[model samples]
Target: MSLPQPVPPSWKDLGKSSNDLLSKDFPFQGFALEVKTKTPSGVAFKVAGNRDAKSDTINGDIEAKWSDRKHGVTITNTWTTSNILRSQVELENQIAQGLKLDVTSSLHPDKSTKTALINAIYKQSGFHTRGALDIFKGPTFTADTVIGRDGFLVGAEAAYNVTEGNVTRYAAAVGYNAPEYAITLHGLNNLKTFTASYYHRVSSDVEAGAKAVYDSKSTHGGVGIEVGAKAYLDQAAFVKAKINNAGVVALGYTQTLRPGVKASFGLALDTTKLNEVAPVGPSHKIGLNLVFDS
Candidate 1:
């Protein structure tokens, strides 16, 4: 017989993250199986409990995947009663696709709204883990972008980072668009969150951005403000650096190959200093990444 795997150390401290990161661009080799409710019914079995005992059932789950920058992005939107489709469209419409005016109207006018639904289940449901410091890491960046006329600019950069990717294992994605301000969301754990970020290009050869994720569950979601910068290298490779948890910092180098492939190596200390933020741990994680064109 097997018992449930206990969540790792310091679980209650981490917040819910999305499974998207696991599928988009990660560099790791492993297999996973997710069990979801199907008909809400299970094989009948005898019970030792009293007649008042309620019947238990098992539901089936859809399989998830793990992708990296080396491959391409895999769009895995399931249709569980059509609501899934609606939600996906809603999210896509909201993403800030730096498109021109002619293209913007053709697509959905983008506006990141702060709604109750967005507040509750934007990307909340997924496998749960308990750990000292779970991480939902990824390298999600698009190669060639489809362009429109005016308002429709670039599709929301389908990439994931410490808090931007899918936030699957360790966090809620600190996501946003330039225009969108005052971001907010509520977790199933009854915890609330807020995030904001901005990007600017210096000399067209170098670009930089900064973002933060705050978890009401603790004194703060991340150790503190998460900041990073990216610089392009001959259109193939780029370098980046960041600091978080009000202390720990990191630096990384990434490269793109052909058009559909990407890879990178990162080094850091205390990477994600959850609350109480400890000293920076080891300072390096060599990652082989890949992402496919969806």
Candidate 2:
């Protein structure tokens, strides 16, 4: 008889569901748009722009990508209005099965600054691991790994500064994932902060999540809590709402306007300032986003 194969979880995706529920679709002081298309020669291009309401700054970037599936190689380049150029190249399943390699670099035209990094990832039935090294700057080294069996997962990550000859950061996480729900606990910021998160798929169209954070080094030294939920009204529209311990409430609505177009609206309000005769600044914030893809 053959035993059931184990599944390895991604270290970076430990609390992704809970994090997305509590953070995604929240309002910001900006308006952004993105358009994506592909060329006949198999090159993909994306143009993105953002307008900051507070700073009155308009920033944008243009990105292009080319992939060769036969050779298992992909290359991408992005140029930003801030005079920064970034590039990344990836190779998958070339050296060995379940192995991937990536090289990324960034250059600043005005400052004449350049930085590069190389990363490697390997994954198998029950194990996953990743490592990265900075070729410039402090020449830091970072690594993380996760192992899972029977829906239980454990992972750890650390980073070391080569120039300083010290371990700059370290963290650990444990999680359990089931068909209906997932729970995770994480020790972050070198163990100075801890967080617990839970996510549940209540029904076909309803999902809920919550997160609690405790900072040992904070002045308040108390646990902060946040809860959020998302519900799909129909095939073309959805709504999200969340509240935090500080009496801040946020709501978001998204709808598909057309076959290739979508729009999202967000609003945030401070309940604590409702009694104040006149709030010092804006007591509410709003955000809008639109996207087009072809």
Cα RMSD to the true fold for all candidates: 20.7, 2.0
lDDT per residue for candidate 2 within 36-79, as digits (tens), equals: 99999899999999887667799999999999999999999999
The estimated TM-scores of all candidates read 0.34, 0.95
Worst 10 residues of 1 by lDDT: 98-107
lDDT of 2: 0.90
RMSD from true fold, candidate 1: 20.7
Write the residue-wise lDDT of candidate 1 on 1-294 in tens digits: 544333121122221121111112222121212222222232111111111111222222232222222322222223221122211112221333311111000111243321111111111112222111112113322211122222122111122243464533222322222222212121222225454444555545665555555567775345345555656677787777666555655666667766654565544445444443222223222333333322
Against the reference, the lDDT scores of all candidates come to 0.32, 0.90
Which ranges of candidate 1 are over 4 A from the true structure? 1-191, 219-223, 257-261, 271-284, 290-294
| Residue 273, model 2, lDDT | 79
